[model samples]
Target: MELTCFKAYDIRGELGTELNTDIAYRIGRAFATFLKPKKVVVGWDVRETSPELKDAFAQGVLDFGADVIDLGLCGTEEVYFGTKFLNADGGCMVTASHNPINYNGMKMVRDEAKPISRDTGLADIRKMAETETYSEKAATPGTLTQLDNRAAYVEHLMGYIEFETLKPMKIVVNAGNGAAGPSLDAIEAALKEKGAPIEFIKINHEPDGTFPNGIPNPLLHEQQPVTGKAVKEYGADLGVAWDGDFDRCFLWDEDANFIEGYYIVGLLAEAFLVKQPGAKIVYDPRLTWNTQEIVEANGGEAIQSVSGHAFIKEKMRAEDAVYGGEMSAHHYFKDFAYADSGMIPWLLVVDLLSRKQTTLKTLVEQRMAMYPSPGEINSKVADADEAMARVYDAYKGDAIAEDRVDGLSLEFADWRFNLRKSNTEPVIRLNVETRGDKDLMDEKTQDLLALIRQ
Candidate 1:
C-alpha cells in the first residue's frame, strides 16, 4: 500500500507518479463511506490536473450513492463556502497550493467546512485508499450538477466586512497566476457597486495553469520579492499575493517590505477584537509573544494551540474564537464556518487600514518594532531529531521554561526560541523572537543555528 500521499492535513503528491485518477477515485469512495454524506461539494484550482481529479473523485462519490455539486475552477475557500452555504455533507478542493506545476493534491472538509486532518480522519482515508477494497456492489450512483457559486461566495464574504466608510486607496495585487484573479475581480466589482473608493492595481491577474510568471508561493523568499517589487514600483498603498489555490495570502508594505504573518496575526486579532471586544482569538504556540500582548491589550482572550490548521480550527470552534491565526500565514475566522480563508484576512486588513486613514506600514510599524523576529529559518540536516535534541540539551540549563508541545520551545527572560522538525521534510524549522531587540534576536538565532549545524 502506497501511503506517501497521506500528508499531514490532506492527500497530495505528483499527479501521475503518486496521485492519479485511480487514487483520487478510491479516496473519494473512502471519504463517502467514512463520512456517509448524502451529497458532496467539490471545487478545484486552475491547475491542469484539477478538473481531472475532481471528476475522478466525484465519480467515486457517486459510485457510493452520494451526489456531488461541482464548483468548477474556484479557490479553496469557495469550496468551503459552497460546503457550508450550500449545505453539503462534505467538500473537497483539488489544489497543489503553491507547489510546483507537476504537483497536485486534495483538501477535504467534513460537513460545514470542518477540516479532515490526520488526527481526525485523514489517516483512515489513507488506509482505505491504500487497501483498494472499494464497495463491490454498484448502487444507484448519484448525479453531478454544475453550480457557479462565485457570485454567492463573494457576496457572502463581503457581507462580513463593511466598506461603506472606507476611503480611496490604491492597492497592489499580485495574483502570481493563481486563482485569486477572478475572485479579486468579483471583490472589485462589489466594492465598485457600493461606490467604495478601493482601487486595485492588478498584476499577474490572469489565471493560467502553466504559471508563465512563476509558482504562486509567497511563502518562499524568492517568490515574495515579486509582490514587494510591485508594491514599490506601483507606489500602491500595499500589496497582497496569494498561493496557487488562494488559501493563504502574503502582504507587502508601502516600502515593498514583506510583512511577517506574525505581525498580521496581531493586526487582524486587534481588528476583530475591536469590533467584538472580549472575543476569543486563537493562535499557535510557535510564535505568540506579540499576539498574546495584542490580544490581551485589546480586552480579548488569547488561546494558544498546537501548530497546524486542524488544531487551530478545532480550538476556534471549541472556544468560539472570533479569529485564529498561524505564523505560517493561515488565518481562520468564525464567520467562515471556523475555517481558514486566504481572502478574508487581507480584505479585513485593507478595510481596517482604509477606515483608519493610515498605511499598512504605519499601522504595523510599532508592532513590528516591538517584536522583532528572526524570521523562520529552515536548515536541512542529516538528523533533525539529533539536532533538536542538541538544542534542547544546550538550552536546558539557561532556559526559564521549556515546552515540547509542537516542537522544542525554550523561554528565557528577554527571548524565546522554537526548534521543531518538519513533518513533511528532513529539515527542522527554527523561529526566534526577542523583546524588540534586533541584536539579541540575531545573536540567539545565530547561536541556535550554530548548534544545529554542529
Candidate 2:
C-alpha cells in the first residue's frame, strides 16, 4: 500500500484502511532506516489501537537494530521529555490528537527532541517506508525497556511555577477521558506534597480509549459547555480542558466564560515577560495586535512566526524566545525545548494568578476589549487559492500593508485580516481584528465573508 499517512508536519489518517499495524511496522523500520539512531523512545495515547500499533512500531525499530524505550501510555509531551530527559537518539508518539475515533497517527522527533516534519525528514521516511524491503539480515537484535516517566514529567512541569506561591483555590480539570488525567493527578499530588493549598475538581478523569465523553477537542463550541458547566457548578476558580493527546489546552474563566485562544497568547506572553524583562516572545501571525501590544508593553520584543508547531519551535529556538503561542491553543516554551506543551500552559497561567493575586478575568478582560477579534472563521470554497486571490484583489489597494508571510495578510488603518488556506483541509480561514472597535470588526468581518463566500 502507498504511504498516505504523511502530512506537512505529521502523520495522520483513518485507521485500518489508511493506517494499521503493518503500515506502522513499516513506518517504524523506515524511521529507523532513515534516522539510524541507536536508541528510540516510543509512546502512545490511550486509544484502543494505540498499543498494538506502538508494539508494531517498536518491533520495527528493533528489527532495524535499535533499542526501544517503551513509554507505554502517555501524552505526546512525555515522549518529547523522555527523548530529551533520557538522552535518547529519537522518539515517536502514536496519537491522532483530537481527530475522530476512526483516525490515528504518529508524531516523531530526532535527537535533542527536534521535530521531523515533511521538509526536514518525514518525506524521506515516507519514501523509504514505501520502497524499502525488509530481510532477515545478520544484525544485533535490539532490546526493549518499559519506563514510567510520570515523576520526571511532573517535576518538569512544576519547574515552571513555584508551588508555595500558589494560593488556595478550587479549580476544575476536565481530562475528557484522554491521557491527561494521570498527569493532572500526579501534579495535584506534587503540589500537596509541597504544601500548596490548591484543590482540584476532576471530571472525566478516567482514561478510556473509547472516548465515552466524545473526543477531548475543546475547539468545538459544544465541548466547551461540559467543562464550563462543571466549573460554574463546582464554584471553581478556573477550568482547563485538553484534547486527546493533551498537546493543546483550552481554558475557561472563574465565571465559566470560555476564553478564546487568541487572548491566551497575550496572557501567557505577559506572564512570561513580567518575570523575564527584555525577553523575546514569539507569536503566530494569525492573531497579532493583542500579543504584540502586551509583549512590547512589558519590556519585551514581539516576533511573529508562521503557524504550526514545527515553524513556531524553529523560530523560538532561532530567536531564543521565552514563549510562543498559537491561536489554536498550542503554547511553546523556550525552556521546554521550544516545543508546545498543553500541560505547561495552564501551570503558567495558574502561577500568574497566584503571583498577581488576581482573577483570570481581571488579567484578560481589558486586553480583550482593547483589541476585539472575531476569532477565526472558515468557509469552504471551490478553490482555496482562488478565494484568497479574490480577497487580495478586493482589499490590496486599500490595505496599508500586505504580506504573504504564511498566506495573504492585509492591514488597514482601522482593521486588518489574514486569509490562509488550511494546512490539513481544503478551506479558507479568515481572521479580522480592529483597533479596539468591536462594531468595526464585526462589519469588516461580515463584509469579507460576503466576498470570500461568493
Question: After aligning candidate 1 to the native by TM-score, how far in Å is the CA of 241 from where it should be?
Answer: 0.4
Q: Write the per-residue lDDT of candidate 1 for residues 34-63, one digit (tens) a residue.
A: 888888999999998889999999999999
Residue 228, model 1, lDDT = 83
Q: What are the runs in model 1 whose C-alpha is more than 4 Å off?
A: none
Q: lDDT of each structure? A: 0.89, 0.90
For each candidate in turn, the TM-score is 0.98, 0.98
What's the true lDDT of residue 45 in model 1?
92
